[model samples]
Target: MIRDLARSVREYKKVSIITPILISMEVVIECIIPFITAALVNEIKAGCGLNTIIKYGVLLILMAFFSLLFGGIAGSTSATAASGFAKNLRKDMFYSIQNYSFENIDKFLTSSLITRMTTDVTNVQNAYMMLIRVAVRAPLMLIFAFVMAFVMGGRMAWILLVVVPILAIGLGIVIYKTFPLFRKVFTKYDALNKSIQENIKGMRVVKSFVREDYEQQKFEAAAEDVCADFTKAERILALNGPLMQFCIYLVMIFVLSFGSYTIITSRGLDFDIGQFSALLTYNFMILSSLMMLSMVFVMITLAGESAKRIVEVLNEKSTLSNPENPVYTVKDGSIDFENVSFKYSEKAEKMALSNINLHIKSGETIGIIGGTGSAKSSLIQLIPRLYDATEGVVKVGGVDVRNYDIETLRNQVAVVLQKNILFSGTIKENLRWGNKDATDEELIEACKLACADEFISQFPKGYDTYIEQGGANLSGGQKQRLCIARALLKKPKILILDDSTSAVDTKTDAKIRKAFREYIPDTTKIIIAQRTASVEDADRIIVMDKGTINGIGTHKQLLAENAIYQEIYYSQNKAGDQDEN
Candidate 1:
């Protein structure tokens, strides 16, 4: 995990290396100051002159200033390196997500990904800052202070070494006990984020159903789970503070009692007052270094879980990739599905789309009608290689979609999905997603074909009108028409509308179809709809049932031969008659 995460520190490596070097220099200066003070104390005791005391005092101040300077510089460099590393990490994760296929995306929750990018990345960044600074300072300070303590007060230094193992064992136990709890806590964080995201996204539905109290209770439950787990982990980590303090006090008591007795009895021959003072300073330094180390370990324990989550995203390879040598051009809009079968995952009990054989000529107008879960969308998704077939070949423009570059195939086959999305941007900007370089005239023309220009021209800003996120400001019919206009800007060879016109009135739907039939006669149009009237004028209609095609024929032909089609068409006509009456 360390090796994987370190790769994000590409340009910051120099700063990362410099931070530790500065920390080491600071530790060295800090250790030397106590030794100099010890010598000065001895000199003053031996009837030293005022000039000698002044010289030692000046040297001590210089050493202290340099220590602070190195420490401050180390702080700046570590912050630069850690923040840069985090920026790079978030960039890499986002770019990776953009390349993932639908199947790969389905493996992770949207909320989980958001948490990994934001909160989890922050946790790792803070831990990295600690690792480069405190982590480096602690060990160096402990080693230098230990050596100096022995030199200043021999035999009493053994007392420091004896306490080290006891503290080490205690810290080890604390970390081990808390690590699993922290891991569980992070998982709960993902759940909490998911709950908040769901509530916000479905706020309208919650309010419509008068379920505000229920949603509040649900959010509180998720939040409580996260807080409970974190509290449990912190409770275990709290032992670390008391353990370190106990060892520090024990060491201090032993040093003072023994050293005072030695000084009084031996009459300054052994462990004198000057040496005793310096020894106490070194003792505090060593014990404080251990305290810093314990804090570092606690941070590492928390960040360990976060780091694993981040690395999981970084290590995930897109389940789909371009071929070594890929076809970049599409010949035409002729699509063929040959003995194709697909299941969302290898472990799925049933196929979403079972062995299907179908073909459509260029410029053909095809309509598909299916019940819920009939795999109508699944069958079309394979044409653009959004998800590859598990068993057989799906060909677009007479070449297997897998053989074509993914971008090339998807561009040629424009899909206006069932759920239309409009980002927060001007109308022109949203339309330009289909063709970034589309001229104003082209935008008007596409909107006209989609029957969206009439409403757009009525708006005060026209094409420049600002759309709220998800097009929430517009009615459902308006959003659908705008999305269609956006897809029409692509001028794709094949256009598939996956129940996209469900919100529009039947008269408007007919007008849009008529415009497509008149203006884009050479583009293959596939429409999936619940209303039979939407597909009755098509060249061919497909009836899908239970993940398989039940019948393939023109509207009148299907109505006579296919039971499912007859049931759907007659029921719709009966409802229409009753409405008119």
Candidate 2:
């Protein structure tokens, strides 16, 4: 996992390397300052000359300056390296998501992905900064300070060896207990993010239903989980400060008492006032380094889960990928499903579409009708290979879908799914998604064919009007027509409309179908609709039931022969039905 995270430090490798080197330099210079201070103190005790005083003072100034210089450089380089690593990490995760198939997306929640990319990345960034700076500085600082104390104070410095083990053991216990709590805390972040996203997206419905109190309670529930875990973790981490202080004061008391007794009894021969002062300075240094180490361990514990989450995303390989040598061109619009079966997951109780064998000729107009959960949409999703078949083969243009370059195959097959999604952009911008370089005239022509031109022209800005995110500014029917127009701009060999025209009026739906027939006669059209009138004019109709094809025949033939089709037809064609033609 550490190696996976280190890969994100691509362009920042030099800065990452330089930060620790500078930190090491800073620590060395700073540790020597106290030793030099003890030297000058001893010289003064012996009534040294003014020239010696000036010389030692100048050395102190130069050492302080050099220490500051190295520390500043280390701080800047560490920040640069950490921020660059975060940027690369986010970019890689987003690009990986872009390649994820529907199945892969199903395995992860949208809210979870958002949290991993944002909150998790931030935690890991902070940890990385400390890893390069304090993590390096503290250990080296502790070692150097201990060696200096032994040289100056002698014999008494060994007391630290005993205090050091006790302090380490206490810190280890605290970190071990707090780590699991922090790990659980980040998991709850997913729940908190999900609550926020769902509330904002469904605010309209939530208000219409007057469920504000219910939503508030739900948000509080998620928030409380996050709060509870963090508080628990914090309480455990609180032990570190008291533990460190106790060890510091205990060691200082022993050192001061023992040194004073030895100096007085030995008549200032064993330990001098200068040696005692130097020991005190080194004690502060060692203890300060230990305190910094506690901070490093706390941060590393918090980031352990976050680091794992980040690496999980970076290591996930997309399930769908083009073959080694892929077919680049689609021959025609013909589609064939050869004994195919598909389930959303291996643990699914039943297949979404099972043993589906169907053949569609080029340029044929096929209508599909089914009750909810009968897999009407599931059937056509296979043509674009949105979800691969679990068994057998699905062929498009006389070649298996896996044999073709994914982009090349999908370009020839345009799907206007049930959900009409429009990004925040102008009408022209939305239309150009199908063909990036499409001209204004081409956009208008596609809009006209989809029967969207009239309403678009009625707006003040015409094609230049901006759409809000998720088409919030547009009506349901308007959004659907605009999506259809966008798909038409592709001029695809095969077009599938999966219950896309349901929001439009009957006359508008008929007009759109008429435009399709008159303008793109040779393009194979598959229409999935609930209205019988929508499929009455098609060459054939398919009725699906319980993940299988109940029947397939022309509308007239199905009305006479297929029991499922007869029930659906007469039910919609009652005396007061608006679909009557």
Candidate 3:
């Protein structure tokens, strides 16, 4: 736990050091103010006049003022540090997650990752701030109070000597029992997050089926589990305060009796009862400090566990990182998969793609048609090194993809995923993501090529029209066209449309493909689609089934020679067969 905390501190080195130092100074003043109060009491008891008493009391007031001022400064600085640390930590986690291989991300659920990034990071941040203020302050006060107690009264200091052990033992028991409980709480938190996220994302399906009640019950069950786990942990921790108070009260009783006897027996001595009273005050201060420290320890233990989980993400090495010596240039956009094989997991024998050998030359339009789960997307994903093959090699432009710098490799490949995503921005702004330096002419040309300019021009603001999150403001076909425009704007050497036009009508799809032929004649294109017409016009068509390429040929050749391709082609275009012919 300590090692993990040290690692977090190292992540934000300057702020971590400054926050703790400020907190330490603030706590030192807090500890000294009570000693000054004890001194004031002693002065008043030593036959001091009202003027002298007022002078000491005034000093105590000033000390307290400084203490409050320093404490406030420390708290504000600590908060700033914690907020900044959390922001940076979250950014690092996001970047690390992005770098993870597709295989690695599949190990954890999307909702679980979201929970870790948001709620789990917040937990660590809150605990970090608490540590800066309360965690550091409590221990310093405990030490200062203990030293002051011994200085004020030697034998009476035994009061703290006894209370300390009792407090430690009780705290140890509570922590030992609750440590496992906290781990369970985090797990329950992940499940609760998953349930809520799934419900929201799938709300349309639930409402369509009229299963709102069932979904609500599912969510309620997850929530109940989380609540029960938290309550159990709290119930155990709740015993600490009462146990501490009871033990401290017993020590107080012993102190009162001993001090009274000493005062009664010390006849005519300078050992005043008020001084003994002051000593008792310091003893209580020590006990109170110990109690606060114990609570801090409990929080640290819980945060320590959370911090470990967070660091696991921050420290993870991406299996798909760029090579040390990478190919930075490509003479032609040719892709080759030589005896390539891949599996989502090592334990799973069923490869997502296996023994795949193919070569796609520059400026060729290749279509990929496959049954579901035939690794259609996975095959193209290798071109940009999204995942490395478990066996054999994948080469791009006559150079191994792994040997190419990730940035250079990816720069040449633009992929439109089946699920279209658009950022919250104007239509023009989203399109510019593909080519930041694209001129207005280039933007219009790409939009036209994507067959999106007509609908975009009809909007109130034309190209400047605002798009809601995920392009919710547009229809499915509009979103698909905008996504295609974004990919086209990049002017990549290799453009891949993974069922990108699935939402559009056959006529619009044909128009977009026609534009591609005239506008991007020099670009290599890979089209993955379930509809045979979408790929029927390609220069080459590859049919895939169960991780293997069943056939490779042009549309006419596939119709004559490939049974799977012929079946899919005939089924999709039975009504339009005469026109297609």
- RMSD to true structure for each model, in Å: 1.8, 1.9, 2.7
RMSD of 3: 2.7
TM-score for all predictions? 0.97, 0.97, 0.93
Q: How many clashes (backbone atoms < 3 Å, residues ≥3 apart in a chain or on different chains) does model 3 have?
A: 0
- Name the lDDT of candidate 2: 0.91
**Among all windows of ten consecutive residues in candidate 3, which has the lowest summed lDDT?**
1-10
The worst-scoring run of ten residues by lDDT in candidate 1 lies at 572-581
Q: Where does candidate 3 stray beyond 4 Å?
A: 1-15, 18-36, 264-271, 575-581
lDDT of the candidates, in the order given = 0.91, 0.91, 0.83
Q: Considering TM-score, where higher is better, how would the candidates rank from best to worst?
A: 1, 2, 3
Candidate 3, 10-35: lDDT as tens digits: 45667666767776776677666666
Model 1 residue 206 CA deviation (Å) reads 0.5
- Which of candidates 1 and 3 reaches a greater TM-score? 1
